[model samples]
Target: EITVKWAGSHPDNPLVKVILRPGMQMQYLTTHEPDDAQMECAIAAMQTVLAREEAEAARATDATEAIAAS
Candidate 1:
C-alpha cells in the first residue's frame, strides 16, 4: 500500500515521508527533499488521490454491472 505520513520537522519544508510498504521492506522518500513551494501541497495531494480512487472504484463497479447485463 502507498501512504504519505509525517516524517519529522524541517526548518523550510513540510518534511513528509512517503512510505511504500508495511514494515521492514518499506521504502521511504520525501517531497521535502526538493521543498514544495506551496504550503498546501500535502493537503492537495491527499485530496487528489482520494478523489481519483473514488472515481476509479465507481467506474469499476459500473463496468461490472454493464458486463452482467449483457
Candidate 2:
C-alpha cells in the first residue's frame, strides 16, 4: 500500500508519502533541508532490499541448476 498525506492549508501542505516494500526499487528525493538520519535510513533500506534480491536470485539459480542436472 502507498499513502501520501497532505497536512496544512491549501497553499501550504506538507506531503508525506510512505510505502513498505522491503524488496522493491525505490528512490528518495527532497527539496527541503538535508537530514543525515533520513539519508542513513534510506541507505539501510536499500541495502536490505538488495540483499534480499540477491539471496532470491541465488536460490533461483540453484534450483535451475538442480533441475538441469536432474
Candidate 3:
C-alpha cells in the first residue's frame, strides 16, 4: 500500500526510501511528493501499527511470566 508512484519520469525525485520490513528485505521509495494530509495519515497508520506491536509484545511477556510463576 505505497502512497507514491514510481520515479520513472521524474528527474528530481526525492531521495527518500522507507523500509517496511528489514527482515524480509522489503523497501519502498517515494518519488512523488505526498500531500500534507497524506503524510499525516501515513504517520498515524505507522504509529498505530507500532503501538499494536508493542502491546502484543507486552502481552506475550506477561503470559510467559505467568506461566513461569505457575
Candidate 4:
C-alpha cells in the first residue's frame, strides 16, 4: 500500500509518501531525516485516523446487531 500526504499544516516540504509491503516492511523517503517534531506530528495524524476508523467500525457493528435482533 502507498499513501502520500502532509505531516501537518506547514514544514519545509511537508508532503511525504509512505509505502508498505506484504511482509510489513515500511519505507519513508525524504530528502533529509525527519526531526522529532515531524515524527510526532506524523504519529498524531495516524492515531487520529485510527480513532475515526475504529468509531465507524463500532457503529457498523451496532447496526448489524440491531438488524439481527429484529
Candidate 5:
C-alpha cells in the first residue's frame, strides 16, 4: 500500500493525501480548510487520477486476455 500526506502552514494553503495499491494508481486530495475552491481542486485532481488508473487497468486486462488466448 502507498500513503501520502500533505500539510499546510495555514488553513488556506490546503493539504492533500494520496494512497494507492502496490501496482494500482490512486490519488486522493485533502484540505485543512473548508473552502469551496480547495475542495473543488482536490476533487478534480482525484478524478484525473482515477481516470488514468481505469485506463491502465483496462490495458492490463486486455494484455492478459491476449496472452491467455495465445
Candidate 6:
C-alpha cells in the first residue's frame, strides 16, 4: 500500500494536505476559496493516477487471458 500526500501552502500560511491512497481517487474543493484553482489540479492528478491504474488492470487481464488460453 503506497500513500501519496500533496501539500499546498501559501507564503506565510499553514499547509493543506491531501492524501491519495494507492487505489483511491479524490477531488477537493473548498467553498471558502470560491475560485480555488487547486481543485482542478487535484482532479487532474487523480485522473492521471486512475488512468495508470486502468491501464495496468487491462494489461493484467490480458496476461491472465493469455495464460488461460495456453
Maximum-TM-score candidate:
4
Worst 10 residues of 6 by lDDT: 1-10
Question: Which sections of candidate 5 miss by over 4 Å?
Answer: 1-32
RMSD of 6: 13.7
Computed on alpha carbons, the lDDT of every model, listed in order, comes to 0.60, 0.62, 0.68, 0.65, 0.63, 0.61
For candidate 3, give the lDDT of residue 60. 100
Give the per-residue lDDT of model 6 (tens digit) for 1-67: 1222223233223332223322233333323463568888888899999999999999999999999
lDDT of 5 at 31: 27
The global Cα lDDT (0 to 1) of model 6 is 0.61
Candidate 5 lDDT tens digits, 1-70: 1223233323244232222232233222432456899889999999999999999999999999999999
What tens digits encode model 2's per-residue C-alpha lDDT throughout 1-70? 2232322123243322123232223433324665999999999999999999999999999999999999
Give one clash count per candidate, in the order shown.
0, 0, 0, 0, 1, 0
What is the RMSD, in Å, between candidate 1 and the native fold over all Cα?
A: 13.3
Report the error of model 4 at residue 59, Å.
Answer: 0.3
Error of 4 at 54 (Å): 0.6
All predictions: root-mean-square deviation over Cα? 13.3, 11.8, 12.8, 14.9, 15.0, 13.7
Determine the backbone clash count of candidate 3. Answer: 0
Point out the higher-scoring one by lDDT: 4 or 5: 4
Query: By TM-score, highest first, what's the ranking?
Result: 4, 3, 2, 5, 6, 1
Which lDDT tens digits does candidate 1 get at residues 1-70?
Answer: 1222223232234333223234324433332354565647877888999999999999999999999999
The alpha-carbon lDDT assigned to residue 25 of candidate 3 equals 53
For model 3, name the residue pairs that clash.
Answer: none
Top model number, lDDT: 3
Show the lowest summed lDDT stretch of 10 residues, model 2.
15-24
